[model samples]
Target chain A: MSHMQWQGYLRKDGRKGIRNYITVVYLVECAHHVAREITSRFKEHPVQLIGFAGCYPNAYADRVMNSLCTHPNVGAVLLISLGCESFDRKKLEENIRQSGRPVNSIVIQEAGGTRKAINDGVRWVDWCSGIIGNTMMVPMTVNDLVVGTVCGGSDATSGITANPAVGLAFNKLVANKGIAIFEETGEMIGLEEVMSSRAVNPQLAIELKKSVEKAARYYSAMGHGSFAPGNADGGLTTIEEKSMGAYCKSGDCQISGLIKPGDRPVQPGLYLMDVVPDGEPKFGFPNINDTVEIVEMISSGCHIILFTTGRGSVVGSAISPVIKICANPQTYRRMEEDMDINAGGILTGETTLRDTGEKIFEGILAVASGIPTCSEGLGHQEFMLSYKTFTPLGPGCLPV
Target chain B: MDKLIKIHSLDNVMIVTADIQAGEHLHIRRTEYYFDKPVGIGHKVAAQFIESGGKIIKYGVPIGSATEDIQMGGHVHLHNMKSDYIPTYTYEKQYPGDANPSLTNQSINQVL
Candidate 1:
């Protein structure tokens, strides 16, 4: 018998999810109010809302929406659309249906108005929630999990304690044949040489280098690196310094592949998530803030997020639980309620890195087995998606 | 005495493990050095003398170049260094190398 005791919401697509949430989606900004109103009625239930604010159709938006709607964690979907918006609601609804999830769409104009559309959406949700509540919980193990790690609000302590500790956790997770992902290529400006050297193959090493190079070009065009004032005040000096700190979240696993924002890992041991957009920097910053990266990970099928913060952040995500690992002992004390794991003990010489990593690995297992993370318990369901461009991954990006 | 931990064997700088005050001394590798200014936790202190425009090596790689010659035990940070790829920003004022990296940031090794 397996020592682990966890069950997942088994999806028809052969994927299992740790949570079963009924998602309310707004196809365009014009329909956001009705979607929010519908979700507000189900505040006591596992109902969450997400949407694209652009009225002009974007292929990227369509791809992300399809991925999110059919995500293993999503039990059902209710879409709100303005009658003349450019989003392809029919295709989205059909995609969800094909994924074996209940889905419905309410066009405000056809439904007579905002109040009517919201009422209609709420009714469908009320009915679908009952049906999805019966979703089978099947046996899941460490091998069945896809986990992503990201460092936000980082300070100097981040690279030393929490980030490396998270990396250790990744190492073990990959050893156990579980999928692990780490991202923010923009912060990896100066470390490409070292990172590429760790790739599993020469082609992947080259892809890793190209990804970071793309990020460098993108940030240069935007006129600002990911480095922030808080980072500076926290003792991080240059973008390269911040990148050095942020890069450790990947741990020391042999990188398996390079994946773009909406691409899931082909077969995961370790994968680098390149969140930067392709082409000229027309879409502004690759990701405006931290939550955007969280959403991207979720869209790519991450079961959970291990978020390490030295400066402290209190946000989570709509479809996944964010496990907050605080790196600074002082910051952990001030934000105790927000943080889940205190990896800061490494700095005080109270805990060893291996032990902290073991705790984080166990935390991932515990959270997966139905324990609410600090973010989940606090009802923090932050999500964001914006238009960006990308060419499909080259064959060299992911090799067996 | 505060502990300055070197993250890598080749690191020329060490990360301060605790909030430190000016004139506080640290003993590392048989050498004693005193802080020149109050430094917060996570700040870097030079492990050796680094000349202006030389690499600020950490984690065994150069994160950036020093803007001024830093003595052993001196604080190593923004005032004394900047990124070769792009200028780091703070709320106080925007650094000049961001929009035009060719101008301000071109002083060091151009890139990786």
Candidate 2:
């Protein structure tokens, strides 16, 4: 067994959380400033401000909220409601409580006013902090880790370098009995046959194929293949070519299961996150941008996110840490400050893919043990969510 | 060793990756190419001569049917190739976007 180098906050659910965060959540965009004030007042308490600003109720929003509220990292939740918004603060509070975490809800209108709400929120936070300070720490090992990988702003070098290198890291993690996940089903199009074959069960293989086919049909209907404008400039000719490269990130591990947004892995192994909505495209795209993907991974119980970028993305999640891996040597040269690992060294012929992957694996350990990523250190806690919907996974989807 | 060059195994034309001076002999995979002109990378050469409206193929996919007869080893992208399927767009035909939505609930103070 791998040695447990770091101790994490032990939860009643038997999960290890990397951080104990007190979140002041706003129910709608209207309450954001007040929620921010509540969190800002407690700057020394590791308090974070996060919430859904949508007045419209959405299934995707609910899914995201459910997963996030119960995320292992969060120890206490304080929901700030405008009192008249569509957001179901009751449900959000209930979910957090169900996770055995401390939760409080304050409706601003019902609480008298903004000043009273913030004061009440701060007092609640202070009391929660005293209680949270008593949670015990448990030893954690590699096998206990839930890691997610996402490749964004990709170019030709992405498939050949950072993506495949992350794949190697994923394989290593899975070999260590850790839970590994990869998303962006639309990018995995043309390689479904190759990908499906890696599923642990035949039923899962069929589900995998169906998901990719659905994504392809969806994109085709949009009159745009997952083809990006930058893709042509980077020398990728087709979606199939991109898919073949993107699929390498899974590192030949047996796909233990398939999950939709906010679903955690049932067993430790490799998993594919189907980011495309079920049925048709009613809820817009699966993710509005890459930050949404990172948020989903964190919600799925990931302690850390391994983000690979060819063109480069500086944004990180509001919760879990994002370790950005740079794929292109040129992009790294241009944006060194935004990158965490220079997988681009592979393109310069200075390092092998395995070497960079090992570097990333080491980086994961460091982040897990409290080392800050570029975004985390720079204080870039970007968050976003839009209206969307999904039908839950079928029995065939989880062949584990 | 015999030289061989197949632009696309399915298409008659071949792409020239290196310089080929006229009368200079070169070998590819197994077939030999007797160069007529020095061909550069991304350049195409005629595998055979044909009249207008002949079909052109690359990588085994029919890029487009030729509008006019062409010779082998000629360029096979855009100018000569046309998509067999005309593209169409409709709002009702929107594709599914990224669906992974995670709730970022940050609960800090109330630790029980």
Candidate 3:
């Protein structure tokens, strides 16, 4: 019952990715510059620089870093370590190797100095790049891909048009056995019940409801609500109203599980990513901005993010492809060059929601098949890492 | 003849979709209104008279509250409307008075 189709890179772990890339991950803030330098040394290489600047340890951060290091798109990893930090680099390398990908780590403190680290990193990356194309390519299909969606700077038109249109694509993806994920409980406050009713089971429905409620309570105590200021200018009055509009981006997929940041979906179905932290809010808000959400989704194994916006955002992630789905007709007309899909046509009477949804669906396949998005071509390689903590999901959270 | 402007079907209030000068005919969701004054974009006017402290409902939600009674088709905005939540102030009125009670030392101590 689905028209969506895809061709992706078959990875060693059996997961299919829309991109096949070699990632250079810096383990600490001190080594980031050198790591970036090494990646830049290979100008034409399909290499991306992603890292965390925090030296302090966080279980949540560790998990996210590990997931990204082993994501399916990655053929190899070159880790730059400061050696003194408690990042558990050895364990992370082991995890990546376990996924059957080529991985190497160079501790800056142990590898002589900055110049030496860069030299060693470049050598390792060169070696990995040599073997990247050697990996046998297997046939990949839409059922093997996993995708996520998030909307930022939403206006009134976003809810009525693009958000629901994304939901349509989400439903199509899920029906075809591809894993679909949606997040930002801060934006899902008022629609918790409506969202829960679409879950695959009663248990997941309960977890879905509890997660958004938790986010609402957390943001309420912070004084500034999760409702963004731009939302008000665009005709949204309150958090609940904004939430109702924001929730439409998920479409009508039956949520199969509730996941936390960096937690991979166990099977190919719809999942609600619980982005809010558990226990007392300690390490600031769960996500500082839009890029943080993109990073979280990528860290959870998404190959690309279907980012919908009404007010416009120009950010693109360092690791995965981002398809900017413009929602507002006026904003789209103004920023057409930056957008990947113009869902605003729905409002112009030029196209139906289904037509816009199909366009986004086809855009996803094209990007997966090696066609670059506007952000990817413009070199908008932005990265952000923030601190947060969470309790591991209990038995009730993930059910088979 | 005119097209009806509607805020929400469940709402008692409806906004003028277009500019309406005084004495102009207005129809909203089948209800007619003869405006007593002009109304601009994002401004609200009642199809009938509304009382003070009444809820300014839109989309079946409370947007804010009216501060004074006004006739049908009269302009509704900041002058005659106020938020239901605690009043917020800008830098101009930093001092405590009946105009701003939440900033008083009494309230501060109570909060502490």
Candidate 2 lDDT over residue span B5-112, tens digit each = 332345555534334466666655444456665544324445666456664443333334555566544434444533332221122234477354322111111122
TM-score of 1: 0.85
User: In candidate 2, what are the lDDT values of residues A48-145, reduced to their tens digit?
Assistant: 88888888888778888878877778888899998999887787788788889999998999999999998999899989988997878888777778
- C-alpha RMSD for every candidate: 5.5, 10.9, 7.5
| TM-score rank order | 1, 3, 2
Best by TM-score: 1
Task: Give, for candidate 3 chain A, the lowest lDDT window spanning 10 residues.
Answer: A1-10
Evaluate residue A342 in candidate 2 and report its C-alpha lDDT on the 0 to 100 scale: 92
Query: What is the TM-score of each candidate's chain B when compared with the real chain B?
Result: 0.72, 0.47, 0.61
- Give DockQ for candidates 1 onward, in order: 0.33, 0.04, 0.07
Which residue segments of model 1 deviate by more than 4 Å? Answer: A1-5, A225-239, B1-14, B20-40, B44-112
Error of 3 at B48 (Å): 20
Error of 3 at B65 (Å): 17
lDDT of 3 by residue, A310-338 (tens): 88887788778999999777898898888
Off by over 4 Å in 3: A1-7, A226-239, B1-112
Q: Once all C-alphas are superposed, what RMSD does model 3 give against the true structure?
A: 7.5
Superposition error at A44 for model 1 (Å):
1.6
Candidates 1 and 3, the one with greater lDDT: 1
Whole-model lDDT, model 2: 0.73
